[model samples]
Target: MPVTIPEIDYEAVFQSNPSAILLLTREFDIAAANRSYERMTGAVGAEIIGRNLYEVFPGGADPKKAPGPARVRASLERVLATGRRDTVGLQRYDVELPDRPGVFEPRYWSVINAPVFDTDGRVVMILHRVMEVTAFLTQLRQAHDHGITATPAEVEAMEAEYYTRVRELQQANEQLRTAHALEREIAAALRESVERQQRFVSDASHDLRSPLTGLQTRLEFALQDASDDPQQTIRSALKDAERLTEIVADLLELARLDAATPVSTEKVDLAGFVTEELGRRVSRVPVSLDLARGVIVDASPVRLARLLGNLLANAERHAFHRIEITVAADEDTAILQVADDGPGVPAADRDQIFERFHRLDEARRSDPGGTGLGLPIAREIARAHGGRLLLTDREGGACFVLRLPRSVSTGGDSG
Candidate 1:
């Protein structure tokens, strides 16, 4: 006795298969696409069921030249004509990413084109099978380029070795992330530095050009006017030359500070230092000093004196009636503050006050003789000694606070 077997459900099998599959009619129009095909191509079965294959994947042909599409068409024609299966080893078929407008991401596939037959042995459809092998091909190419030759057993071993090195790979990936972050930070810092240098150059050029141009014009006028007073023209040119010399000197000092030139340190009493420096300045502004007894600091005396001179000069220019200097020390730090009874600095300009060649617009309008580097030089000196000079809030005046580390030993000469 012979047993009868039940008929297989071919359509159900095609729909449920894990591999991406598409069925096209004899004219190469899409007849049916499974779930896997929809996922792979970002296509819907209902939308593309009757559309031409080339219309759905326009990338099958190169847009610029017709050869790409012609080649693909020729391959399909040959498969249909011979009623045989054709294998495409590798093809790049870029697809638009879902929800990403106008972005076609790259994809690679190994594909098979086989003819499907009807009951009368006529070619009824084309069965397309696609397997994405992008990662495998990429690794294979990289291994070949690196001169790695492996047998089947060796390949298996190499795969196991790759698994073992996963932790190391993860660590390397983390290091790469850290390195990228550091690179971005460095790039930003470099850009900021470049902008600062450009601003400095522009300011310096303008300042230097003013004096030089004036001097040149004075000399040229003196040469052209025979009857003009030689002595007066000579004096005017000398004054312009003097202004240029002062600007050049300030530039040199700033350059030295930027080069991190070391200064000799000595313990000196802050009270005596401030008093002596203030007395040296010939200013009509009535000065007041509040001295803290036995307050000493380790610092370069010359640099310290220069710092005080700049601060006093600035205060003398702006102060209306009086200037006050105070020296005090805590266990760890010494504070020296200078306050004036004049209009205080604008809030917006406070942050940029210590930048090189930065001058207040009002100051430039009133006092054209300033070199614009005084506050910057003073701040650089303070920083060299591990301290800071900052503008503190004050009512009706500008107040500058200079903080420095107190000397470890208070027993030093009160020079």
Candidate 2:
């Protein structure tokens, strides 16, 4: 006797799948959502089905304060534009508690978004899938509270990456401070010099205290735990030391800038210079360049390169899909603009962005490696070379505009 096989229910399969999933319309309205998604978000399917994605779980009062929604929106837009899948790795997007109206609960998610193409090859819907990783991240946070630790091999890799450069550069800081003491002393006789010096000392002291305190705490922990792995303690100490070295190095660079160190100037082709800089950089986000030839600037090649690097680094910290760079020139000024598609700077904080040791909360949350001095350093370099760097207004993300005096003698070939 032959048995009849039942037809599989596609909707049943979609709804029963253990992973949290949602189907969104082209306009980002929730068309359908799975039970797992409902469970994960603590919302009923009825409440979210017809609402827009952002509306369903609004990113707090100040949208800028909550980067999760912006990132999600960006990823979805990318999928719609490219007709491909995009993955957002480990995002800290908090979810609103269903019981408590305005209060949000901390949540971490690993998200993947894919486009559902129609017969005409247009994206009709987006398949949004998310895995909640809050538990895993919470565990890691708890571990961090105890002490920083890494494997022996990891420590070796970090040392190879950070220690060599630090060792070679660390001595220069002390030497510069000692040799330039008299110069600083003479300058301190100026009107605002005393206040400025005191502020610098205070800022430097505060920044240095963090790593020093961490190092001391880790050593004390090692002393307390007789059974603690010596290698673990050493790794932790090395991590803090590396952080200290980085701070010191940045401080030294700022000191050199403050002292008005003289550097050699040359006729550089702006377009070609940017092209070379792009080649040396490795970025996760795509970069688009628009280079106009014959744009020349009289600049110190090394210092100008550093300024460009800092701008690129700042863009990388916030950029979502792409970073756009353009080089052009007017009759008297050479212009270079770097723009990103990430969230733009808030109006109130625009000028303060270049202040030393000032970092936006989002920037600090996203990038732990930054010294909060990149923009300030870039501005200083620009000023030193008789140029100016400004965070100009852009639609989607932030745009950094660099304008330098065009060189009268344009002798260099395109490069």
Across 1-415, the per-residue lDDT of candidate 2 in tens digits comes to 8999899998999999999999999999999999999888887898778999888877675668886788789889878877879776566687777778888887877789999988999999999999997776455445534666865555456545443454345345435644776677677677477787788888889888988999999999999999999999999899989989988977888898999989889988889899998899998899999888888988999889989999999899899999999988766788999999998899899998998888889888878656788899899999998889998888899999999988887633333
For candidate 1, the per-residue lDDT at 23 reads 90
Highest-scoring model, lDDT: 2
Could you give candidate 1's per-residue lDDT for residues 1-415 as a string of tens digits? 8999889999889999999998988888999999999987789999898999877776533544433344455556656877878665445566656677556666666567888888987778888888875566457445645768755566666655554464355446546756976999999999997897788778889999999999999888888989889999989989999999988888888778878988789987899898888767788689888888677889999999989989988888889999999998766788899899888899999978887777897667657789889999999999988999999999999999999988887644322
Off by over 4 Å in 2: 1-189, 411-415
Return the TM-score for candidate 1, rounded to 2 decimals.
0.59
The number of clashing residue pairs in each candidate reads 0, 0
Q: Tell me the RMSD of model 2 versus the true structure.
A: 29.2
Off by over 4 Å in 1: 1-164, 409-415
Q: Candidate 1 clashing pairs?
A: none
C-alpha lDDT of residue 241 in model 2: 95
